[model samples]
Target: MNKILIVSQQGLARSTLKTALYGEHIVIEAGSAAEAMARAQEYRPHLIVLDMDMGGENSAEICMTFKEHDATSYIPLILLSEQGQKDDIINGLHAGADDYITKPIDPIELLARIDTHLRTKEYFADLEKSDLLMLFELIDIISVTRNPKKILDIIVEKVSCYTEVSRCSIINIDIDGNLAVVASNDLKKNQKITLDLKNYPEIENALITKRPVVLEDLGSNPLMAAVKDKIKHIVNESIVVVPIIKKQNVIGTFFLRTVSTLKGDRAERMNKLCQIVANISGNALENAVLFETLQSNKNMLENLAIRDSLTGLYNHQYFYARFEEEFSRAERYASPLSCMFIDIDDFKKVNDTYGHIAGDLAIRKISLMLNQLLRKSDIAARYGGDEFVLILPSVDQAQARSLAERVMTMVREVSVPQLYGQRITVSIGLATYVNKNYTSYEELLHYADAAMYRAKSAGKDSIFVTG
Candidate 1:
């Protein structure tokens, strides 16, 4: 509904205006120019009605003040004066009144003029919003990138900048009814935020029924009486929640909150726009999810070709390819690079005593430990049977030796239940590149392997470092 502020010192005229506008609009009555100006700033009414005889000397100043201020300048003002005051009408227009009506109050003429101003304001607002929502570039990017979260972040940020709302958020609702805030204008400040719809009955009901929810006057709505106190932090006066659905499934919701109330045609237009946005958002999210699934499948197929079947670690062939890449990068950067060749101590004896199943279990356990103890830049691979290799970039001889010792200790302490009472241990050989002594990557691997043989011969379960 459009808001109209009536500034009239005469009680009879104020009451008459209220009676005419009451059901069609929300009317704010002010007895003086000071009160009217205060209400204009606070409520930001759509149209302001000023009485020329209302506030003595400050009356004309108030009209000029509203016109000059950014917040109130767009609001159309109509001056009310005595019938024969030609000079007063001219003065009111000069002070920035959009239109003037001479009184003894013609109700029909006043109502008609108010209707014209309100329609004009609504039309302009629609045009501005339409321009804001026409984001062809964003839609095209979402189609090309398959990164929905990035697009959603852009959507939330742009929507907040363009809209009249205080806050805008896109929430993802899971199958079990858990709400996760996927994208929002405040994501950087509040990470991984979630809300329980069970606490917000209005929203919960909307989701259940698959419809849009609007709290036009949140503070005064009796339906929200039970949760009103709790909602004060959530919304100052109004909010709208539109569901985003995919393939007949309600996946998420778009939320908008406001400090001032929205009603009637304004609320209706917002609802329509939100529905269109929700549809676009829902389709984008679905495409993102589908793309992620397809990518995961593709990655799994590639991994099967280059990963150890038992441990799911990179196989020897893939490890050799990665080693060349890392070696070249380290040489160019003149960075410290280290390699470790690890062998399971007496693994043949364990397999003969316990069976092949126990051997596989032990291998899997050690592979997991390698992953857990290593940094993201460090690469670990299952190099053929009962052996593993590690590429530790930016690690020197001392650091490599220390890491090898830690791994040896950890492997010794591991007790595989499948191997019964037998404890598992590993012997490691470490090699570092001080000044690229090895001409080829094969020479580096051979040096690490020779050191591993020395560790095994030196009564196993120990680390041997070599250059």
Candidate 2:
């Protein structure tokens, strides 16, 4: 409720104005200007209905004093005067009185003026609250430490709390115009693949034009083609697609969907809110995309520094690093860790028979086959061309031998598409490091390398264990 201060000396006049305002506002009455000043500081009224003629001295002087004081300077002052003289009205306006009415005042006019000013203040307050909440929610989502997809999920959930946009989804468009849903508050379990826009060109055109597509009938609409099969009965409802733009180019779109069509004032109101959501979300999405892009690039570069580019497997240097890490972990936890050094059988002969390109392809295919067989915890690195190494943490001797056999089987079974050969095989040497058995990880690898030579001499495609 708006606080209103009434400065009038007569008890009768105060009671009359009290009845005029009634229950619509809280009225604070003061008999003298000094009392009014005190109440002005305390009440901080939205509008002050001041009687200039109440004090014995010139009323204009009191209005001028109210204007000079910072506490009452910006408060909307409605001057109440005994006479509406041109000179007195001019003086009142200069003294910061927004409007003046001659006393005895008309009740209807006073109520109308008070209602207008109070409504204006309320409008500003609502806008301020909306802005604060949006900033708070956006900051909360950005500060989260989970996966990138989780951030998109939080954004979708918070949009409903913001305004009347009941639901929102965040989608990302790849270079080929495939629409992949990054996050959605609704449909959390749905994992349908990319939406082909070629089948639904109207939605694409609407988004690119930067105009919202207000669909009254979805069954016949062009955009419905993209969403119809996925959501049953959704094509029969209304949809509003607001395109999210970044740097003048459209990145993705937000769906403001409803079960029924809105017309007249409601449609216009929703349209305005949609524009506001677009402006704010567009800027936010751009920043998120830029941050995510930089992060992805950093990860790509870090992996490249430690990975073999040709085979997309870890390099020999990474194997050394992992060996040290696993050795330290095994010693600390008192768990068993093992390694296997593998050498492809007759790789040189296979390369000479075909070409270096076929050799490269063979190595790549073998690497992939081994990867498909290994668990995610296992690390496979290309120790050198035609040779690889595997590190298994928390694995005993028996489990390591079993894992090595599975990898050999996978290598032998895989069919290389380009350079076909069924004679490809591998020789693997296994070594295990129990508690305190090896002082350094280098010695562990040395034992495994020795066993690898034993396997080569004994027979190809056979695993040999360290003594």
TM-score to true structure, per model: 0.38, 0.38
Number of the predicted model whose lDDT against the real structure is largest:
1
List candidate 2 stretches off by more than 4 Å: 1-297
Q: For residues 1-467, what per-residue lDDT tens digits would candidate 1 score against the true structure? A: 98999998989889878887878789998987677788998999999998887646556788898899998999999998875466778877998999887655555446656865666534545544443455454466566657667767766775566656566777765433456777777668346687876556666555544566777777687767778778776454566777665542212334432222557666666565565566566777777865765686877557667877667688888899999988888888888789899999988888667654356568877888888999999989988679999999999999998898889888888766546578888888988876877766777889999999999999988888885
State the lDDT at 251 in candidate 1: 25
Model 2 clashing residue pairs (backbone): none
What is the lDDT of every predicted structure here? 0.74, 0.69
Give the clash count for model 2.
0
Please, what are the lDDT tens digits per residue for candidate 2 over residues 330-353?
A: 999999989889899998877656
RMSD (Å) per prediction: 29.7, 27.9
Candidate 1 versus truth, CA RMSD in Å, comes to: 29.7
Residue 150 of model 2: what lDDT? 54
lDDT of 1 at 112: 54
